[model samples]
Target: MPVYKVYLDQVFLGNLVMNYAILWAAAKLSRVPVHTARLVAGAALGAAYALAVFIPGAGFLQSVWFKTVISAGIVAVAFSPVTVRMFLTCLGCFFLASFTLGGLAIGIIFYLNSGRLSSWDGIGKVIEGNFWPGILLGLIALWAAGRGFAALLKKGKFENLFRIPILINSGGKQVRVEALLDTGNQLKDPMTQSPVVVVEYNSLKSLLPEQVQAGLERDGEADIWNILGSLSESSLSSRFSAVPFQSLGRANGMMLGFRPDEVVIERQGKLARPGRVVVGIYRNKLDPEGSYHALLGPNVLELTG
Candidate 1:
């Protein structure tokens, strides 16, 4: 048996380029912010994935769990957990790039070898002999292809369209809300200069009395006086304040209101406290099944101010 000498050549260079290209493509597709650190991390991951095959007794590294963990680790280091949308986008891009490159390699190998393409036994031998070279070459090729595809799509526009989840808190309960940051939701209470947080009536019904909920559903405006009279006796009555505002269509209805002890918005791993927010609970459903309880409209000044 003769040992074959493995050498890096133009083919290996081509593969390395491909690997970087794929990583760049993945980053763009996912709309994840890419920097030198992220690129380096992705490249390192690709190399590790390649090394997994050649290291004898490193069988554990070949498992699905190992691969997933490795990939996730790379993503976590590269992307921040700012919003669900961003996270999903990054993961989608990564998997898509990986599959595309792997498929391309398999296709090319099959085409070159024709009907005499190597079986698993022969393939394993080839991999074992030229493990490092193959890993480097394959990653480069995949990365380059991915980058080219990403470039064709244009990175900036794709990222601009990515929406992130909005975090809202009212009273003591916190709800993770998916809200499109609409610049058009400019509804505010003129007197107090407070941003009116709009919420569907049904969303907060769970927090209201059954009778009050039913009355709100049946008699909309007619139930206002009665509801207010009842609220006057409740513990929230002392804390409640009248916020007069006319809806787009509805002529009259008292805006049922509450003063949230505190309100926090989480974005990009940082918490923003927009205090003295007036939460308006409505009687209708904003969306099917009431996906959101309330919308944090605009900020209002505190009574002390």
Candidate 2:
């Protein structure tokens, strides 16, 4: 009998690699909702499962069926409300990756040992220097492959993959909100031709002047152009404008617009200013679920560039 010593540190590192691989693969395969914190937690669970092989009474976990169950738990931890089809696909890909890596490691180990299969007997009998090196090399190769796959996906569908965070500055105040990239929002400030970003009135009410806020809160019964005349003589009044738009059941109506002091998109930990965007107050919520309050115009991205 050979004493198989499993180092706890190695087990943790191994689990991290496996977890990242599965997540990277899934991101490449489809447009699935995922977050970094969940993936890290899932990786910790996987490392615990891998370390189970070293426990005296947990030997059964090494069995194929038991390992499959553990892997399922890992997948569930990493993604929320995964469909049956997606779960199966992820599991199959994990297995394929495992087998591929195992084969590659074994082939390299055998080649390094003078191509003599018999010299590298069962693992219990001999401890060769090349054994760990081969495994390390295999791990590195898998990480590189996973990263390459993710890079391609980011290049293709990067914008759709991430939620956009925006800050609207107006009237000496600033409000932050999430926004959806909306190409259909071609409404603009009629006077300056600047692009418009539509937002729910309630979400941005605090930033509006008290007088302006009270006037627009009447369920929009009064015409916006008429309400504009009542604004006080302030910089905020100068910022206000009327935008004409045609929507369902309404042929011609005006939405209240304001030239923001600055409209910025936070990307990659940096604030990118999209020059001179008008914020239009939409009486209705853009997202009933409240995932995002604003519908950002495609022109925002174009102007930022």
Candidate 3:
């Protein structure tokens, strides 16, 4: 029975670094937006838990149930997931990332110790050996793998990713169209603060007022603004709004958007009506091959039916 020296500072700092890295990797793998403050808080909580295990009366923290609870808490604090499925996804990714890094660390330790794992002395020798290089290599490999997956979804399998049917109801007219969910299309109406769905002008032209359609068809920005201004006195004034958005080549771009009476989106055999959605009219074609008529935003999917 040998006693080992445990430095509180070393344990806390080591856990803090590992926890933050694991959290960031999970967020990237999950494709969820990361908030720096939230990640820091989550990492600090995890690091504090690691320190608690060393306390004289805190042995309960080492139980399986406690580990599960703390892991869930860390993910919830960091990601702020809106649904059970999202929370589970984040948790799974977190575990995957943790296991990957842990495996890499273990492999490195064994490699440095000439593939011997029979004694605790071999583990202690890891401190004498250079450790960061191997860990940094593992991190880079994980990052590259995540990036490669994203590129596959964006470029390799463009058409199969979350393409769904959408039905727009307005002005006693209904327009059925195909939409490709674009997570990057986070455009929202500045005035009403409603999510904006970018739709091709030709696809949704039937639902727009004749004057509005004609106004949107015009080439000049000034004329488009003038027509929209005059619509203030019209009966359908409240339905129309100006949506500001930024894209790859265009900066400070404005699009004409109108509120639909109802919008129904079909996802995996179920119909969902995202609340307060505004349809932003895009004059150009969304897809060259006519695959999708609209670019759907991921934010709208968060709303309940």
lDDT of each: 0.55, 0.71, 0.81
Put down candidate 2 lDDT per residue, 1-305, tens digits, no spaces.
75666679977887687666555555444444467887777778888877778888877889989888887887778765655555665666656776766776666676666534454364322225565677777767777776776677445344454467899886578899888765345566889888888888887888887766877877637567666877756656788888887652275877898777888898878899989888888877765567678877666677788
Candidate 3 colliding pairs: none
- Model 1 Cα lDDT, one tens digit per residue, 213-247: 66567742535556667776677654344555545
Cα TM-score per model: 0.40, 0.46, 0.65
Ranked candidates, highest TM-score first: 3, 2, 1
Best by TM-score: 3
Worst 10 residues of 2 by lDDT: 118-127
**Best-fitting candidate, scored by lDDT:** 3
Please write out the lDDT profile of model 3 over residues 7-26, one tens digit for every residue: 89977887888888889888
Q: State, as a TM-score between 0 and 1, how close model 1 is to the true structure.
A: 0.40
Count of backbone clashes, every candidate in sequence: 20, 0, 0
Model 1 — which ten-residue stretch has the worst lDDT? 296-305
C-alpha-based local distance difference test score of model 1: 0.55
